[model samples]
Target: MPNINILTVDDSVSMRLLLRAALTKEGHQINEAEDGVAAAEWLEHHQPDLVITDINMPRMDGFGLIEHIRAQPRFRDMPILVLTTESTAEKKARARAAGATGWIVKPFDPDQLNSVIRRVAH
Candidate 1:
């Protein structure tokens, strides 16, 4: 797998740690944010190959963050993946509408997550 830069956003510290360990082990550069608000701040100064975000967060949610990213012309085509516990069709449709590139349910497998990053970042 290519060494891609990725932003992993989640409210849970454990989730962020897990993602960092998994991605770093695959030689991918990983940046982390505890919530959507922090992720937004991070995005201000950095551009990553992909963004993986959780749906439920303080200040902003994944859907809201997707809208924010899509609204900006420079980030309009940036790949965004929603990694959340919710798997409802309605939520998926909403995320797609908000410009999410893909959706992955929470408790994600490391290999599957890396595979998705490869596919989307390509």
Candidate 2:
């Protein structure tokens, strides 16, 4: 697999650590953000190969973050994977509508998580 840079945005500290450990071990560099606002700020300063974010967060949610990224010409085609505990069909649809490339429910298998990252990362 290519050594891609990844930005993981989640309000939960545990979730971020889980991702960092899992993804970094798979040879991807990880950047973390506590919320959508922080994610956006990180994006402004760094361009990553892929972004994995949580749907439920303070300040701004995943959908809002997607919209913000999509509205920007530079990030319009960027790949985003929603990695959250939300498994509702409606919420998944909303994420798709907001320009998410895919969804991965939390407590995900380590291999499965890596697969999702590989599929979306350029």
Tens digits of per-residue lDDT for model 1 on 1-122?
67988999999999999889889989998999888889989998888888999999989988888898888888877899999999999999999999999999988999998888888786
For model 1, the superposed segments whose C-alpha errors exceed 4 Å read none
Q: What's every prediction's RMSD, in angstroms?
A: 0.9, 0.9
Model 1 worst lDDT window (10 residues): 113-122
Please identify model 2 stretches exceeding 4 Å from their true place: none
What's each prediction's TM-score?
0.96, 0.96
For candidate 1, report its TM-score.
0.96
Query: What lDDT tens digits, residue by residue, belong to model 2 across residues 31-88?
Result: 9999999999988978888889999999999999999888888887789999988899
